[model samples]
Target: MNVLLFGASGMIGQGVLRECLLDDRVESVVAVVRKPLGFTHPKLREVVHEDFTDFSSLAGEFKAVDACFFCLGISSARKSEEEYRRITYDYTLAAARALPSNPSLTFTYVSGEGTDSTESGRSMWARVKGRTENDLLAMPFHAYMFRPGYIQPLHGATSRTRAYRLLYVGVSWLYPLLRRVIPKHVTTTENLGRAMLAVAGAGGAGEHILYSPEINRLAAEGR
Candidate 1:
């Protein structure tokens, strides 16, 4: 299967990209990024794109793509709602629109756990993500939304954001305990990637929105 990946440099994206490369089922991976990934893989292809709002020039890259892992996202910490919406809603929709209108194609978007599908929520990021999810589901392709919480970065995968990195480092020692105590709400980057592949391979069947428990189940089933 040919896979199209976005946000390949991010923490979650890195894990997903690693799994795609390791899995023999995946033939090739095309990663869209603003800068080079600085590494080479036999099955990996990097496409540098500066403008996230427009993906018209990358239309050819989506051709014959069986699955697309849209992991692009940003923290809404201090940014205004407008800035967050631009990256959260606008960029995601642009990519979804750019893909071929093939019903067989699987498009998995990485959203957080508390994302509001109502599109009217107290949280700005959740509202924008909710709208993005709603719009993508309405598209022709087979789409699924992933809502993972407390993802443990495995195999050296680290977040690009400094605050996240620090948090992960501080919490790394407690992840095992957390996992045992709250298995349903916790998952690893490895499992997340595997789950995405599993859903895509299943032709986007089952639940449209997956949480950590469901994600882990899918990963195990895929294995």
Candidate 2:
């Protein structure tokens, strides 16, 4: 399978990219980024593009793509709604629109656990994410929304956000206990990556929106 990946430098993206590279079924990975990932693999191809709102020039890269892992996102903390919406909604929609209208294409989006599907919610991020999810589901491709809560970054994957990094550092030792206590609310980067691949390869089954428990189950099934 040929894959197109966004936010390959991010923590979740890093895990997905690693899994894609390791999977024998994956032929190649085209990662779109503003800067190089600095990590090289024979199957990895990096495309440096500055503007996420417009992807017209990168049309060639979108051709013949079997799956797209849209992991690009930003924390809403300390940012205006407009800024968050631009990155979350606008960039995602632009990429979706840029891809060819193929039903065979599997488009997986990484949303948070509390994302609103109704497009109307008390939380600003949830509402925007809901609208994005709703719009993507309406698209022609086989779209899947993954909502993972309390993700444990495995295999050296780390968040770029300082606060998130600190939080992970403080909570890393408690992950095992947390998983045992609340397995449904927790997942790992490895599990999330494998789950995406499993859903894509299966042509999307069960539910369009998968929570952490479903994500973990899919990962195990894939293995």
Candidate 3:
């Protein structure tokens, strides 16, 4: 399978890339990024473009892809709602618009928990994420949304926020404890990555929304 991947440099994206590379079924990977990903492989191709809004600039280059994993996301802290919306909502729609060429493409979105798209007057971040999720679901591609909470890393770290870094650090030591006490919403990066690839390869059961427990389950099954 050929995959069109975004946010290959980010944490979740890195895990996804690793899983894709390791999977023998994946024939080729086209990764889109703002800057060069600084890696090369026989099966991997990188496209450096700063603006997601103008994906059509490379529309002709958008070839047949079996799936698209949109892992690009930014923290809600230190940004206004409008700015957050542009990144979370606008950029997502931009990518979706370009994937119609890849008929029967499976789209996996990294959405957060507590997302509410009814234009509800609750948290701005959740509302934006919810709206983005809803909008992407409306697209033609077979879509799946992953709403994971407190994603712990598998190998390397790529969090831009210091607070997130700290949280990951704490999670490393407290994962066992948290697993015992935490609800099913929280999941680690390794599990999430494994689940995503499994779901993508097997095809989803309807428009699936995989919460943390489902992710962990799939990851376990994939292994």
**Best of the candidates, lDDT:** 2
* TM-scores vs. true structure, each candidate: 0.98, 0.98, 0.93
lDDT (Cα, tens digit) per residue for candidate 2, span 69-155 = 999999999879999999999999999999987888999999999999887779999999999999999999899999999999999
Give the least accurate 10-residue stretch of model 2, judged by summed lDDT: 199-208
31-118: candidate 1 lDDT, tens digit per residue:
9999999999999999999999999998998897999999989999999999999998999999989988789999999998999999
Taken over the whole model, the C-alpha lDDT of each candidate is: 0.93, 0.94, 0.82
Residue 84, model 3: lDDT of 93
**Superposing every Cα of model 3 onto the true structure, what RMSD results?**
1.6
Compose the digit string of candidate 3's lDDT tens values, residues 1-223: 8888888888899888888888888898899988887778888989889888769877755667788889999988989999999998899999889775544678899997777857585799989988888887878767889988767787784676678777787668877777878858578777877887777777656338888888889889998
Compute the lDDT of residue 75 as modeled in candidate 1: 97
Which segments of candidate 3 are over 4 A away from where they belong?
none
Model 1 Cα shift for residue 52 (angstroms) = 0.9
Q: What's the TM for model 3?
A: 0.93
- In candidate 2, stretches whose alpha carbon ends up further than 4 angstroms from where it belongs are none
